[model samples]
Target: MEIVGSRRKNSSFSSADDAAVVSTIPLYRSAPELEVRLDDFELYAIHRLRVLKGISDGLSRGKKPNEMENLTKELWKVNMRNSEASEVANKDIISHYVLRLVYCREEELRKWFLSMETTLFRYRFQLETTDAQRALLKEFDLPYKAVSNAEYESVKEKLNQVVRSIGQPLSSADTIYYKVPFEQVPDLVATRRVFIFKGYAYVAMNQVVSLLMTQYRSHLSKALVLTNRKWTSMILEQEKDRLTPIVEALSTSYLGPDYSQPREYGEISLKDIDQVAKSSFPLCMRHLFEKLREDHHLKHGGRMQLGLFLKGVGLKLDDALAFWKAEFSRKVGAERFDKEYAYGIRHNYGKEGKRTDYTPYSCQKIISSTPGVGDHHGCPYRHFSEENLRAALDKMGVGNRAVQDVMDKVRNRHYQLACTLTFEAIHGASCDAGINHPNQYYNDSKNILESRVRATRMVDTLMYAEV
Candidate 1:
């Protein structure tokens, strides 16, 4: 394989700096051979997964370019620093190859991994200097050649015209264009970003980044498929005992905060539950809350879903009993509420039956659930019919435009993204962290509302002091 050590005079890394360049930016064309401890293997895979999840979440929340850049920088510092440390570089390579193995088992997982990893690669590529980019592309052995002075002299006007059409600055005398096959860059062609001449795309210096992205995506995608085919045979029987469990766990891992643990907060008051539900609950929880209020009872599924979410957001056992009792007693009476419903509520808090202290359901779990007739437990964005979803958005006071945007995501089967849009519309602000769990939505909404209340109180105090 052509590695980073081989450099031309124009390459970003000189002989002295090749080691640093090789360690920092990865093409992921080949798997790295390194000795990784079991602990480091698990930790590295989780760290990389966290970064990929961060990228996916940021995109779902409609983060702007600069905001995403900032997020990437922050995540990189914490999870993927581009340091000179050999361990850091080794971890980066091993972690990436490990995820390829983890996600390669399923077509859906492969597609998701490809999309997120490509976006990540593009982000890192764009951060590089032009010379570094050229060096990397050369190492990859891409066939695109730079347009010669004679060729540029003939087509400079046409290239300048295309540049002007796209509203980019005119190409300078020093600017270089690459003659790439038009078939390779359909994105630029379809978008009219590059000037097409005959059958070749005269990709501008800046536009070469897109070409690199396309090449890297194709390379990584094929690598993943090949990895999938080889996975089972590649692991020896002895190694399988050690590695198989880790692979299985990583494949199904939910790496978000542990909402199952008790949080530090005052117990939720029964009187404030209704207002809090309206202001802070995710649509799934909100639907369950409203249905329970209207009917004065919830079926087992709805109770489990909402009960655990309430517990996650800091509802104590006594308060949870009183809250459910007030609603259930309206129909079943206090006697029936204690006999049937109260024990189940206590079970969710680790007080009854097997006493498993259940955590709130994530968007993935909720989306995967099949809500039967008369059940309002599943994700609204996933389960609600188009008309029902639209009406729910209208009830939340979301504007028609935002509602349509939410519908678009739901149509694409992006249920969590749709929930994120609803959160943004209701709060009139972007959800920087995105909505993965009902409790996360509630906590984020509560914080936003509390901050607004504090701001309003400060304004009121200042006005009264002037009087």
Candidate 2:
């Protein structure tokens, strides 16, 4: 299927009124015609998705807002920046529109895209200078009542108290407080971060992003609903045949490295499997490993999940057969294992049936999988019960404070962030390389452990040489 915005011959490109330009606020109000190439359509959408995912990952890593700002700046520089200023601006605007089309299909997809886009806008808004922010408000026609000097002085003490309690130390003379209706800034009101006087919220200059964000979210949410309706009802039959599949697939696309290639790392021995799992595996794989060991058999889903991950981590097919045979032999003898279970293991290695070499599941795939009773597959952060997840964290020796933080991420449905938190708690260091795929986590953890070992060996060699 062709992309949505491909230009036809003799058609006007972008109008002067709809020129591609990046502004302080990227409120995409109008759809502009573009001369986008077929290849550029998927490329632009992937790049923008990475930026949005970077924001989600930053928050998942427990980064403060200032830290998240730095993270996104670097991501933009790497992913969205172009040599020309206008080109960069075009990418930003065009990519945003492309993703809107991709994500406007379902309610869940729309909600996720809306939340990430709003957070992105809020981060950019927070970085603008005060004058720039005011200009943006004026440009967007967001009217706010600036408190008079006399009215500000009347409530100066109360404003100071509220702002101070919220850790914003702005003196009365220095700050420009806006008197927005309490309803407009309900988040601040509910959190008791702003001083309320008569039906108005006294929001400090730095806090105006909250009001703007609320408005932006409301507008974008309604726009997505309308877009979905139009997408289904108004598109021409020819356009639907060309555009539907490409747009739908963009939402669940995985842009990470391929895991189906031949193993570059050396083969892992069956004897070392337990040690390797403990040291390098993500919690999902580790949990599955333990279950397989305990029960001496795993259901089909668990076998596929853990089995593919093992293959990705350099477990050769021979060792894999031995490993599964040993476990299955405990319950149903080696004969039964070879008769019933051995074919599936060989199939995963591309030696039987259709012989299709399947890639390991990414975090998105695992998170979306629905595991029924007796299944040990899927992301533990997303699938495990809270009590079970907390116990798992405790077993891994994650301290109480970090456990609470992980739990908070889980409660907010930030499953990947919870996994990142658990990684930090165990390693006692930040997971600088965010976890997007199960094999990525495994590779990262193994590299870290290997580095520590090499460092320790170097220190030992120096001490022995001196002796």
Candidate 3:
């Protein structure tokens, strides 16, 4: 991918014919016809193109009709011209540059940018042809090389053993091996996916994608940190304004895989909220709920966190308002509750103020946010001390073993992983999925329990049939 157009170039004033001319020049036209090789940074930038497109689409969601139409037109033009190698390359380069501007602003955003780009790289690499894969490897300048016939013969037995352990019957001769530093691919090492001899990991060619992605992520992460430090030191107002949409889009982006619509989870009435809070709420929300119940009040941050959660669980607007009013009225009186608190609830429901439909706080948002004194809005795994978190889990009836498991993850700053472990512990089932959002935790807990009931029923039916 090659960067096109000057920074000061005004696309806003470009006529339709001008766009046509711009789109005609292929970005990769300068490359040799039969083969293509991208520099390591260029490869990283190419992967970022897909991520930028996703961010742009997400950011455009709540725009005005005219703005949305223009965005749609731009997207259509990109799609129509994607068949041309130059247009694709130009689009990739431009999007990458835009995201660099957007992501350079904050550490969290930079990490998000790196993760997305790495995922894109993994996906694209998986889809590449063998020759293309070799080209990319050459560009990456990776230390791994194909095992020679003589080297394979020496390592044949051990390699076959590793392959058999993974439940595959691949022969040593048939398998292509790459000798890479074991430290470079810790995931493969931790998962026992590769055979290590001496200092190098004998990774099968098919499994190399994971190793490559890890390397890519590490390299890109460091690159981004350096880029952020350099870019954050400088202030360019016009460039900032130009990249504002990309930044805004990233903030609102729900990178989770499953965002189930409201109705699919079934209607959750205010009456059942207490029960749901006990059984379904994640530890963070559960903590907030308990605090609210005990005090009959919460700070603004806590209210926002719990309120949006209630909204997400399908509580009707009137029910949500009434629920808050009733709870707060216990200590503050009905008039005080109405006067002080009603508008904020209404605003969250999109019936007041900006009337924007607010989304519930995702795991990233909760984990990254800092709660001040008296606020209980942030993630417990992130914000809670080890002893306090352990005590809370003990009080909730989680066994010592499970509590220890969760604490181990928490200590590593894997807050979401800790949350997933908590879900598994409480449900008495392994949920082998990452917890990306609070709502996702709720939904997964519900699904796991429901699936257990289904499995039990199926077993009972089979037994009855045999009898």
lDDT of each: 0.79, 0.79, 0.67
RMSD of candidates 1 onward, in order: 6.6, 9.2, 13.5
Which lDDT tens digits does candidate 1 get at residues 1-467? 11111112332222454534542478877777778889978888999999988887777666786788778767877997535676777888899999998888777678878988888887777677765776676676764333335667787788889999999999876566677778777889998988887888888667776777788888888998898878866753446789877986787666787777546444677878888888888899999999998998888889988888888888889998988998899999999888988889899999988887677777755765677888889888878989999999899888999999999999877778889888999998898667888888887887888899999999999999999
* Candidate 3 residue-wise lDDT, 87-160, digit = tens: 56554554454456557667767766776566455555655655456455545555433333666667778887
Candidates, ranked, lDDT: 1, 2, 3
After superposing candidate 3, which stretches have Cα over 4 Å from the reference? 1-105, 143-154, 169-176, 234-236, 239-242, 255-276, 279-283, 295-300, 312-355, 367-375, 379-467
Whole-structure CA lDDT of model 2:
0.79
Candidate 2 regions with alpha-carbon error over 4 angstroms: 1-22, 106-108, 129-131, 139-153, 167-175, 228-249, 255-257, 262-264, 269-275, 291-307, 316-359, 364-376, 397-421, 424-436, 448-467
Q: Worst 10-residue stretch by lDDT in candidate 3?
A: 1-10
> Which of candidates 1 and 3 reaches a greater lDDT?
1
Count clashes in each candidate, considering only residues at least 3 apart in sequence or on different chains.
Answer: 0, 0, 2
Better of 2 and 3 by TM-score: 2
Q: Which candidate is the best by TM-score?
A: 2
Q: What TM-score, over all chains together, does every model reach?
A: 0.70, 0.74, 0.57
| Pick by TM-score: 1 or 2, better one | 2
Candidate 1 Cα lDDT to native: 0.79
Worst 10 residues of 1 by lDDT: 1-10
Winner by lDDT between candidate 3 and candidate 2: 2
Measured by TM-score, how close is model 2 to the native structure?
A: 0.74
